[model samples]
Target: MFHIKRAYEAYIDGFQEITMIIPKSNKHTVHSYFELIYEDNRKTKLPIVTRIEFERFIKYTVFTPEDLSLENKYEIEDEFGVRTDLQVGGVIRSNDFDEKYAYDGEDLGASYSNHSTQFKLWAPTASKVKLRIYQSHGDEEKFTEKLMERDGKGTWKVIIDQNCDGLVYNYLVCVNLIWREAVDPYAKAVTLNGKNGVVIDLSKGSHVSKVNSPLQSKYTDCIIYEASIRDFTSHPLSGVHKKGSFEGFHEKGTTYNELSTGLDYLCQLGVTHIELLPFFDFEGIEENNPFQSYNWGYNPLNFNAPEGSYSLKPEEPMTRITELKKLISVYHEHGLRIIMDVVYNHVYELQTSNFEKIVPGYYFRQDERGLPSNGTGVGNDFASERLMARRFILQSLKYWTEEYDIDGFRFDLMGILDTDTMNQIVTELTILKPEMIIFGEGWDLNTSLSPSSRKATINQSHQLSKIGFFNDKFRDGIKGSTFSVQEIGFIQGKLNHDYLSDLLLGSVGINNQVSLFQEPYQSINYVESHDNHTMWDRLKLSNGKDSEELLKKRHILGTSIALFSFGVPFIHSGQEFFRTKEGIENSYNSGDTVNSIDWARAERESSYINIVKEFIAIRKRFNCLRFSLKEEIVRHIKSVKVHQNIIGYRISGIEEIDRVKEIMVLFHNGLKDTTIDLGNEDNWEYVWDGTKHYVEKGIKAECNKLPIPLLSTVVLVKY
Candidate 1:
């Protein structure tokens, strides 16, 4: 076969260049001439040859008539028909091109019915498009190819006019002279390992949980708990039968030593939402042997399909979809919302990705040197600002919420996406689920996108009011720098009043000093998550010289502050039970040995788990702690200086807060005990004496004269 990599018009009104690899076997004579052949059987002769070598490929520069157009699909013939076709490479990437061919129809993917199934794809630059349908997912030889007619406005479609349910298929789009085979980006169901798209009738009903998620009117009411499929159930003692699969996670009544584990344990923890790490069709872990490998699912392969490995029967495409919906129903049954961790920042393999294969240069952002941008520290940055790309993301988000009833979204590397796109996402998703919780990591990475304001980084928080961002300020303030293990914070023995103040106010700007966020609801207070070191491991690393007992106190104190602080609280899966990864900071690809949640530790540290549960209770009890607006916080909260190392904040009365009039939260960060006298004040009860709750049997004001414990947190209330 003759290899013609690409042909591009580098400069207008000049000769075009064709890049190819000519080995010694296919060496041409000096008199060898070239001609262009169109699909319509027209021909044009070429008289010039220019050669430049690159690695193994050679660039042959030649000229055709200025009047001749290269926009049509054609082939390069040596004389008449013994030739190769050149792929188009010089399609300009710009907003103008996207607008010209953007398809606004909702029927982009396979629309299935009992009688007819219509398939549509959006590929504007393609010369021809074909559909390849396989009778079975694994049968490589048994398939049929059908041509697709270009229906106006960049969409190619074909109506089977017969039932195609359960049949596997892929698109063979002949764009730029190369016939690229790719699964439909809009495919709702896919075959094992996501090799091909499966046609299924979504109109039919499937099994789901009967119970619904609790009403969460305010966004601040969310208490997010992050976990992964394998990490949650892969442990040998996890008491799950289908370990590391969706069925395993769905199985309830599981426990170790009678203490709840797996799905049951999540409900017992009292978190409002469970944010699962990417469970979509990712590019890691063998579906046949999921236990042999471990991946956090950050490497996205297909944007809209659920991962097959998590299903009980990955070989069957419908099984994956059915099981995933059942898992979501379980979360709903427990009054917990499910948030899917979506990775739209980059793809797993740029060159071989479905987006690149369907339309090479349209889905990615390129730099001035004509190379892909690597802002995500990955190979390429997904250009979400583009019209078509943005539409795809919005469509995908709608599919998950409407199809699976997912209650929220935790965007990964959200900074790589555009601000306008993020704003549109919340507007669209909330329309389906009004109480949807949308949050993401907003770190400003060094991506190639220009005019930084357009990117959805934290710096552009003002433009995004309804969306929430992971408050790194709160994270570093409580657990110290995630990068510098030895660095200390307020709860880590070192105190920065400014950092404490910023975090306590949910990173909302205070006293004319604009902070990381404009509203408290926009700040997601979290000290530990899937990324970086768990708070337990960080404590051990930072205070390694200290005894294990003291380290536990530090961990509890940091977690307590994050829980009670003003924004939505987030917890790692096994954080309450002192989850440790053997000090592995970045465990994205580390095997199950380094990533699995140790239920054995959950049994050992159940006391700390109780403390976390109580903290979540206290946060949910007080409306002042979960204020959504900046005005509510500015009007009701004020800083109090009681002692040298003790940081205290007071919350005045709010009508929404019932049974509690005024609240005072005190944190003692010193090395020694100190007396925090109440000045003989009456009715100043201790609701929480550092570690214990006293809502029924109040600890009187006399308890205030008692010396405060070193590195402890307490709540005082006057009812």
Candidate 2:
């Protein structure tokens, strides 16, 4: 009969008000009288402030001199004794509410001890809270229900005298007078399919030793190779027993036709870090029949728990943790670090998400009309600016870094988040691991967050200098637009020397031009990643009339630019062998058929793969390519006045950071051969001429002129 539109503290100090709507169907003659019933049944009469008649309902405002606690639910009664539960409306999204109920205690989730376990849940607006403990995660009936006492900052707490290890639990929160069950938002471990939270003994596999990763002096020195645990080993020819699982991903001695296929292949390929797609607990796959469906794990269901489908024993909570740890350990031992692709920009769905269930309106952003913001395109942008929301993200990242020994985090749709959150993430994660790599998709998206300048998009990259952004400019400038296959890039003969030169110089400002980054490492140079079509596939579409031989070289040219650019180089899992997705663009749920990494392609494209390896070696060998500061890049790197079809640069101070005195790079973007002027003294040598690479095997060129291979990247090193 009545809807409580708002019951919040007015901006004027020491004043409180309530707004309610009474439908015309409730033909009560006297609708002005009302009383606010507190939780203890104490009734306080409210004075009528204003009323406005509408077509179908009458809007009424009641004023109270006293400020009531929003944490304690109240009820409102009309003159006819029709009572309605006081519901949270626009107030929960206000700054006053966030400051009052923001919980800072680290014990928001179940904290286990040898003899006792304490559980805490942040449900400030709930009328009642109950803890449901189940013997098993999937049990329909709970073993027992216990009432929890309200703690400081609107959190509910309860202590169990016995150990809670292996026990499954969830909270039943009574909000808006309706009981709803939800998993703990801070759950570190979950049962199969993330149905319930598990009290995990974190010390079970804590004995895993530190991995012997390679020495990377700077973040730009990292050669990132992105892969998914499922796709990396899902191919039928992948020589491993545990297909598409954590154990299989790191399985040693895996090969096809006596060639390395899985982890071994990555090791030999010279990549420093392996960026895995979200391996955290996500939706879209049945844990019981994991092989029946496929997902890239972007739909985050649990922040701290590993994905169940990737574990061999999904039913065992500890199995996932230990197995994933072992996987990281294996890579670390092989001199490769790991970076997790985290999707904190949004949840899989807002309505069914634990954040909405616990604190309905606190976790996500809302538009002026009070609807969920869809900046993420999947509904609901995470409210990282909120204190409690930021706390949750910070804690989750720390847990992964400390517990799983995670080296870095790659944020998904980072633009939807606030700048403060991204800065804090980089600062804290760097403390835990100084050699950490942090970057994300900083695409400027339309979101409800005010002051567009505060978004962590590339537009605000100067504010977030420590974090890197995926260089869309590099992708589009070198390989064409990722979204369109018909558009050709500089490598495909759509040469724009000045534009391509900016990208080759790491997209940082040069020659008074506004650039994308303040520092060189802030640009993540790559043409292919997990999100778009492979470089081979795109070149095939854009240059449809070109031959396969020329297409392969064009693909190599783009990869070459990305690797040798003045930024962190990134490579997709199957980019080397002309890997195609059969024209599929968004393969988030494309199953194993189109997404799996075909090992056979490795054998066919071994030659191209070797060239990429040499490019990596050159990048690692030269410090000029991995300049940490903007001043170093601006001073050392100079654009060469080469032909219009070629992109060229000279690093003069190479003797300072490397054994070589200087180096010159030429990217020929035309279809015809050309001559590049070399010194007549015969002091330069061919470090890479498309056919061979490496300084030790460099051939001396005793001439003043050098022939540039068409659609090829050439490097000349001075000794």
Q: Which stretches of candidate 1 lie over 4 Å from their true place?
A: 5-92, 203-205, 692-695, 703-706
TM-score against native, each model = 0.90, 0.95
Candidate 2 per-residue lDDT, tens place, 341-392, comes to 9999999999899999887788999888779999889988999999889989
Compared with the true structure, the alpha-carbon lDDT of candidate 2 equals 0.84
Per-residue accuracy of model 1 over 1-719 as CA lDDT, tens digit each: 12444322222122244433344334552324577666787878775477665564444555666433334566676643356665555433655466567787889989998999999998877778899999787887899999998887788999998888887999998765568899998898888788898898765436554457788998888889889998899889899888999999878899989789998888888889989999999888788878777888998988888897888788877778878888888789778889999998899989888888887788998888879998988899999988889999999999899888989999999999999999999999999989998989898987878899988987888998888999887888788899887677787777766557667877877645568888888988888998899988888888888888788888888888878788788888888878899988899989888898899899988888888888888888777777788888888888766787877688886645756677888888887777777675667677677754434447665645746778888887877
Query: Candidates' lDDT values, in order?
Result: 0.80, 0.84
Report the error of model 2 at residue 177, Å.
0.6
Worst 10 residues of 1 by lDDT: 6-15
